[model samples]
Target chain A: PRMKLVLVDHNEFAQAVAGADEAEIIEVIDHHRLSGNLRTKEPIRFINEPVGSTSTIVGIMYRMREAAPDKSTAICLCAGIISDTLHLTSPTTTSTDKEILEWLAGIGGIDSAQFVKDFFAAGSMLREHTPDRALESDRKVFEENGWHISISQIEELGLEEFWKRETELQGALQALLTKHSLHFACLMVTDITRHHSVLLVAGDQRVIDAIDYPQAKEHVYDMAGVVSRKKQLFPYMSHVVTKLDAP
Target chain B: PRMKLVLVDHNEFAQAVAGADEAEIIEVIDHHRLSGNLRTKEPIRFINEPVGSTSTIVGIMYRMREAAPDKSTAICLCAGIISDTLHLTSPTTTSTDKEILEWLAGIGGIDSAQFVKDFFAAGSMLREHTPDRALESDRKVFEENGWHISISQIEELGLEEFWKRETELQGALQALLTKHSLHFACLMVTDITRHHSVLLVAGDQRVIDAIDYPQAKEHVYDMAGVVSRKKQLFPYMSHVVTKLDAP
Candidate 1:
């Protein structure tokens, strides 16, 4: 077998990608915040932007390449942004994020407003969610500076229900970490109304220590005003982790 | 059976509500530019603030009532604003609109970013859409100076598809006018990137005449650099119409 080539559950997706045939992992494009595990031997252009959505990142890449977002891609990416940022209602929304989304709508030839309604209706079927389903529904990969991490987001019914199921979600995530051999695993249980987050950590304490959020010491970071994982949380974590990891 | 409380399909579900006993209409609240066909009682609160979204008008009203949006109501209303203004990306977005949306979010206890994402995703699907769905999804309700009208918005789509489908959408809208006995009907197709709109007029010419776009001629009005239908379009139109309709 070819080194048992496989797709790992979360952060390992990037690690499994390392040292593979150059043709195999020729182009790596992701929109999640930077992870400490990413390294490439070949000279490949890496594009990352702090926008509301990774689909938005892809849209920007297409723009830089002077390529328009295709209809399907546009629809998918817009949905990603809508799903990720909650329609730019989050504090994470910047003028740049809005401008890129508008530009995407122009090239993608779709109405952003209409797409938002349709996309939300699809994702907001909360009545059908199990704790495991809720936990795994939205997972993102991160690779940066040789340490890989994966974070999953769960939008619960309310704060009470979120804590009620935190243990179950942690158990599921722990199983996922062991199964995937991820260096760091996290789940951000965001209380949308309260504007707070419970960052459940399951990995090396050193790695968690490296993240070193002023609010992380409680092991339950209250992102009271932290509305965006992309524009706010991810960028802060990336900088802190990099400074700590710097030799 | 009942007095058959007629309403244009473009009006919001709340705007056309009739009294349970008499089938008499209660109030008219709309943000679409003026239409001359509404015949209501002597007293009504015709609130129309054309800023960015009808939700803005409602927000202002809530403020006037000293009713701060609670966390749930704030998220829903904030979502409405973000959805209506396209995350404040619309040409219609104003500083006031942005400020108000932010204010409502703060009051409503939203995680702003997640709320936006959830709201956008809730409303962003537009694939395989018909002319009717395209036109009806974002309709605004209005009753102004005793004249009631509803304006429907179709934002950010391909010009080719819009042109191909506009005639049909217009026809359907005209059918709505007859059904509701509305005196005026307007359809606005907005280009988010270019900040322009193509205005289609039907119903009363006097009402159409009452509409103020000093630059307007026939159906091809130039709403260049215009973004928010609430802020830019309706305010200009209301000023002109109120001037023209002065009794």
Candidate 2:
């Protein structure tokens, strides 16, 4: 059947659900960078804003249209905003995110301080998954200057689990480099409670040598207070690749 | 000095002002197809709707924010909506466009019927300008499948002036083809009062032969009721080019 789709949260067809290219995109509400490839037969409703989460934009729309989400729906949206913005601690958080989060939390009857603590403690990817699964859990591939770089992020309550499994995670990242023919592959284990992270990378030597973060060990870097993949690490990696010495 | 910009009406940087590539695009409110090349250092506010005119979107924003344009600004917006949608007669006209136009007219104390009559009578491109000027007055270039095609549109009260200058208009299109190294160049002379148009072409033989519109003469097609370049004629030309036999 021919389908009409309204894309939310993300816009790039690369990150969209399978077979989205064949569907007619009637509307898009996103908060990511435009990938510049999506085309429609005609103009459609598209709204992209620079907020911490797309859930923030959706909440704004509800207010604009004078519509109210059910309590369960409000809870879901609140979770989206909390998870994506790392409980509003991420640098990506805007004033809109803060305002909408409060509104949604009020509607959901959620105490945000308690909610944040419970959310981060609910799942520890480092402890629950095998090294390979943990590394692959939230991975994203980016193309920068002919380099295919894969970055995976895992959010946890503390760095204790990561320290215990660091060796195995490094091996998994190395395996990912070969399996995907990736120029660089890295995993960021972020301690959301502490608002810090440590990066484990395995890839081209020149790219690894370009890391300026204080080294925790041979392949790991202690990145204090860096939690955002979109606003922080991705831009740093893009700059490194852009400034790499000519082959 | 660096500058920040808010693009309205169009999104493609190719159709934007000079040095747009170097400027920071802070926001965009448009009603055209997204060409998708735009990239900002950070996520910016972007709103694109499938309405008849960008003015309609601005009017909507005004109402959404609980603000109103002054009388002169309202009149200008009305003119923009009227011109783009052919006074609510173009196929691109949406319910939003009609509603917004009425609101703007009321704010400006305008009699829409009389305004439409005076607006179309204000300028006749074919009568006031030479063939070259008329053809270049409202031109846009598009690149599709490696073909650089230039399409220009002139809106007039009637086709009488176009008929008087058809030969020179044809000559100008041929000149445009050579000057720009364009694969195809065409001019659409539209009669807004009657909601019809006539297209004149000078291009590669394969592309020219591929046009399926009713031929009015050697190089002109009678495009009855085809008043919109964005919604109607451009799509037809694109289809014609896409179906041309492989060289």
Candidate 3:
């Protein structure tokens, strides 16, 4: 049976709903670049802006329809934009994102600078949480090149904190990979102070074999200059996965 | 004095506000192709859909914010999209435009077949109205290439009907030129059945001098196959205006 769907935030079929192939996506409001050779059977309302967060688009929709999002919604939207763009410092941050964030900040009575600092400080306490909590907290799942894969990132105050918890984190990731039925799983423990990342990978042997980055140990790779997952890690690993799966 | 502005449907400053420079445009939700040197002082949320009507964008906005438009609003929106797309027959009408129009039709309880026939028949009475009413009914004013200009289009059942009213229409257009202080003005009288247009021109001597088309009379030209104002007339006239005014 043909059914109508209005997709928001995400567009990729993997990230979309279950049995997406059966549904007719009438509209897609997204901020991410088009990927997965995406094509619809019929013409759809596809709005993809080069912005930091999907929350910015929602904010614009609120304004256009002459509806004010409640104070909590404004605050939540503001927080999403700020957190997604790393307080307007992320490479993905667009001016449109900044514009909405500012408007939301006004509505929420938020001092943006103070909020970002507080948010980051709280995030840096990831090392204190149990390994399972850290693994689950910031996890993002994706199916890249027919691989049911996932990559989770944690922003830490120091690299030493991540190194101390490395073994336990890998063990937790292994359990997560099996639990989620993921083809592979990776955790990027990033030092927010130093702007460096240490990747802990656990997955199918083929996926592990495909990646040939500067390996720090058996499954850990030192990704020094990479911070953004969508920009740097996703494309890099997608290439590797594609090459390995090629007939 | 800085204030917030959110532009919809149209993009150009000349087409937009009386004093657009005074307010900072925070967002622009539009459907037309971007024209003029559309540079905002600050970053603005620009949502340009490749659809037929700005009303479709508004319809999408209403749904996104979970705000159901009232019946009257729905009818108006449906009519706007239908009229703008020439009852979903125009080349500029995208699938998204059709999709939104169908939804609006359901909401407004519109009989699409009956509505289109009536709309076209109603529009065909252009020559019967007073010259001023005919001129102002479907007029679009623009500032193209430093020339204050305007284009008015009329849908006619027969070319002879427009030819019958040519002199009076020109007289009213001349008054319009003086009233608006336009450098030039054009009225495109399109024969719906024949799919051809007879353009009535009245303006600055230089603009009249520049047109290389077969001069039907002192101020009329035959556009044998041109029907669309946005697609055919605007761009063609823009080039001519720019060339005539080139320093």
Candidate 4:
């Protein structure tokens, strides 16, 4: 059986899926806040980093598996990490990422200047994706404090495309909430390269309004230097949850 | 549930396990040998490197986890890796190990000279175990061509003790062959600090006799500067395996 991607925040799900027959579980590359339960009986290869994206995780895996990462895998992983983390611009970018990036640039045959131009161009494909598609494409689901919430990372073409996608992103977020039966949904319309997250929260206005953050424009919250969901968003979200639950 | 050890070649497992359960796997530290199957389901703050021992793996984990490794754990891990890989003496030792050892030495509250003394002393417990136990403790299982083989390593004990333990080590090795159901077992007794492996083989005599290494001694094989498994033993073994399989 071939391997499939099992994106998880909890260990049991990972374990169950990994333990299942027909699941080769050949590789487990992840970047998230930690949760122990990564044990699998399969002869699997894994790469985990504290950086912003699984792309960085895959980059390291490619190097370890092949002793040298193939060009395509290297570029894809590098591009994934850059887009996910918003370059090294994300606050979540660690010394490890810096180290890995340097190594990746050497291995992946990347020209930093050229990569930046191509990367933004790929992410800035605003016309191709609906706001909902953009929001849903990179989403993670988890149960927080009692309510099940979904967080989506929405990146678009810089200032020019931001206003264009704003309404669509908002509608997409609402659609996702109803479709998924989520208590609430948060879309971080972020310019990772710019190191800022324009957080859009909807569904339960009570949940949205109850959370505290720097107001960008009323209900929209703006967080500076917030490129990584694991490092930056999760902690702030936890704080927001605490505030909402305050007696 | 408490976190169990989940060993991998990377950091993602460590972080994921840490998040899944409140039972923190606590420590993760590994030398990057690309062997072993370890599983975990709790945040196991781990440190893995292209080093020589899981002991060093734990030391780095200590630095990251509690922001400090206590005296015993620090000493144990330091000694473990040093003893396992002969104190960054092996060719397999990565620059990460060199860098981390330097950091660990400072943080673990010990000097380099003292660490070497303590680690070697603990590892060179030649008085405690028979030749076989000493030989088998640092064993690696490798499959080359069509045969499965086990390689055991021993390092830096006086000639007197090595000879004294030879008979016992041989007997223990015979038992290991039966226990593991291996095709063959090879012991590389190396004076890592001095650079040599007293190559000992058990199983098919044809396999042993077929090896045409110039320095090989009678009754007991002696190869000077054969300390690294990757650089030395692996090549020799691969060659020997090819010779044995040649029709």
Put down candidate 3 lDDT per residue, B1-247, tens digits, no spaces. Answer: 6887887776666676688757776676876545433433222355667677889888887775568688889999998987777777766777878888888889888898998777777755555689888888778787655788889998777787787888888899899999999988889987766778888988898888888778888799988777778766777887788787632
In model 3, what is the error at residue B19, expressed in angstroms? Answer: 2.3
Task: Looking at model 2 chain A, report the run of 10 residues with the lowest lDDT sum.
Answer: A33-42
Which parts of model 1 are misplaced by more than 4 Å? A1-24, A30-43, A60-70, A89-94, A106-111, A124-130, A140-150, A156-161, A181-184, A192-195, A203-221, A230-247, B1-247
Question: Candidate 2: TM-score?
Answer: 0.92
Candidate 4 chain B: worst 10 consecutive residues by lDDT? B34-43
Worst 10 residues of 2 chain B by lDDT: B238-247
| Residue ranges of candidate 2 with Cα displaced over 4 Å | A1-6, A18-26, A245-247, B1-5, B22-24, B245-247
Cα displacement (angstroms), candidate 3, residue A108, comes to 31
**Best prediction by DockQ:** 2
Query: By lDDT, highest first, what's the ranking?
Result: 2, 3, 4, 1
Highest lDDT among the candidates is held by which one? 2
Tens-place lDDT per residue, model 3, A69-149, is: 888999999978877777776667888788889988998988988888787788554557899998877676766557888
Q: Which ten residues in a row have the lowest lDDT in candidate 4 chain A?
A: A7-16
**Superposition-based RMSD of candidate 3 using all C-alpha atoms, in angstroms:** 15.5
Estimate, for each residue in A142-190, the C-alpha lDDT of model 2 and write its tens digit: 7767878899999988899999999898889989999989989999989
Better of 2 and 3 by TM-score: 2
TM-scores, one per candidate? 0.37, 0.92, 0.52, 0.50
lDDT of 4 by residue, A66-130 (tens): 46677776776677667655677676666656666777777777897789787787646456776
Instruction: Using DockQ, rank the candidates from best to worst.
Output: 2, 4, 3, 1
Task: Report the Cα lDDT for residue B99, model 4.
Answer: 62
Sorted on TM-score, best first, the list reads 2, 3, 4, 1
- Candidate 2 lDDT tens digits, B128-181: 888888888999887766778999998988889989998888888998989989
